[model samples]
Target: MIRQIFLALTLAAATALPVAAERIGDAARGATLFDRQCKACHQIGDGATNRVGPTLSNIFGRKAGTVAGFKYSKSITRMGADGLTWTLQTLDAYIENPKALVSGTRMNYRGMADASARADLMAFLRDYSDQPANIPESEPTARKSEPTLDPAILAIQGDPEYGAYLSSECSTCHRRDGADEGIPAITQWPPEDFVVAMHAYKSKLRPHPVMQMMASRLSNDEIAALAAYFATLE
Candidate 1:
């Protein structure tokens, strides 16, 4: 029964992201930027080859991982195999901030926060000449009543639609499925639990440096919105 509920929630989260193309960036400019800024650390279309860093040919299709050859502080090989592929939005956030996207990753790109630049980068990346890729299976679930939302969290729940919009940022590491290996799918969490957990991260209680930084940056309203939206996952 519990597994059934989890699967339903995942299905609901999948539908929450209605895939759509964004036209806000210029691929030509992004390529130039990539050559000037990104070439030193990462190579394009090299297929798991890691020199100083992992190859980025099919980056959007990969889960968090370390390239086979390059030495990683942590062996993220398992993350890649777990099937939590990167999407355009996830790419954008990671571009904006790498360590924020994956807490323990070793890549040192501070990030390019310009919306147009990042968008253009993603566009360029999506078109890299290579094999077509596929995202793995999503979570499975059966029907169940919506989990009870915490009253305090309910008062601060932002627009469910907007919360849905913001959650794209979360999925970079959260994985589409809450149950993916090594990753905890927070979408199944109740709002109160979400809020409290985030609070723990925001404060010094949680020791993950990256999570703490990201959590500290989020406003209370943002946290509330995220909690509410994640709670509503199908």
Candidate 2:
């Protein structure tokens, strides 16, 4: 009887796992993820301005590629003219892989492969936008349909060449060959160490505003590639 009860409990827990996983994007957590991923190229909230990308202050419901004075790729502009709005679903899909959705966009970062991460990002964007939308704590239908990837898995599969490409923005402050006065030399470090240090900055475990801000924009794969690249630099 006890064995049967134990089996039933295990099965019940297993059944509940997917539902719990579906509510993956916590808004607070999303805020952190957003800081790390989108803060560099884009700005959101009051007094926002166009930087490398347009201000995302009131992105949802706005037609794509329509922000005044900020240039967009032909594909994005065409899509906007064709009636593209930045709804949560649409943003989620595009965030997964921008080029896949719009062929000529100039946004350089690779698409996020993790559905949960994308969802979290969506939540953050929604919260900060001028008009926010309510996303449920959990959605049974969407949870079952969407596939997810763990960040750890993506990091393990990082590509060094891509890391080298992404490192261009980083090179301005972080010297490639050696350390500047205060900036420690990242060259010749172990890949794992590099990842950990970056995560520390991203999580605010380490406290340099610039480093935290810079580390916030990196995805796991990008981070992995950067780690690999820097590890091999010496």
Candidate 3:
């Protein structure tokens, strides 16, 4: 009888250990981190507007790049077309590394490297987002293969010298040395990143009317040249 009791207690304790080990992020801690890192470009909750990025309320389960007036890169909108929906899993991966998940994404953030911090931030975001009754148990770990760029867009040899001349329009809003104001900094970014952004704007996949209009005026070659120019700036 005593042996049976001991075995039962051991089993119960073993089961309870796993449950205790689980890490449900603290939402309050996440709120603090969000204010420090994300508030510059994004807003959430009551009376948010489209700043450098979109307001992130009700973001979960929504199609990517479909946030009304907020402009999104073509890469993101295309992901939406491919049936990408923002869930806690996907958002965690995205927050961890935007470029890894979506190459050519116009969001310039490198990503949050801390796993615990990411969980905390996600918890906070989940509070604001239209969360499902039950969140998924796993993170989205697989990265989708990046699509190929248009051959014409890829073939153009960007002339950095010519690009310098074309950069006048860009300089009006974007600081050449990459300072962070309300508008994002474009200086010293990868050339492809610049090209991808311009093409997204040109195609209206990113729905900023002013950017669309500006991008429309340039040919693919000109866009490449502009990318080259901006990439060289430090």
TM-score of every prediction relative to native: 0.44, 0.47, 0.49
What is candidate 3's TM-score against the reference?
Answer: 0.49
Name the better of 1 and 3 by lDDT. 3
Candidates sorted on lDDT, descending: 3, 2, 1
How much lDDT does each candidate structure score?
0.61, 0.69, 0.73
- Expressed as tens digits, the lDDT of each residue in 5-26 for candidate 3 is 1122232333333221233367
TM-score rank order: 3, 2, 1
Clashing pairs in 2: 36-216, 36-217, 37-216, 37-217
Worst 10 residues of 1 by lDDT: 138-147
Better of 1 and 2 by lDDT: 2
Distance (Å) between predicted and true CA of 6, model 3? Answer: 32
Best by lDDT: 3
**Better model by TM-score: candidate 2 vs candidate 3:** 3
lDDT, model 1: 0.61
Q: Which residue runs does candidate 1 get wrong by more than 4 Å?
A: 1-20, 46-49, 75-84, 129-234
Instruction: List candidate 2 segments past 4 Å from native.
Output: 1-24, 130-234
Give one digit per residue, the lDDT tens place, for model 2 in 1-234. Answer: 112211222323433342322332567777888788889999988899999999987787679999999999999999999998876667776887888778899988798887667777776776665531254432222222121223463358558899889888778877997777777777877887677667656544445688878877887778888888878875
Task: Judging by TM-score against the true structure, name the best candidate.
Answer: 3
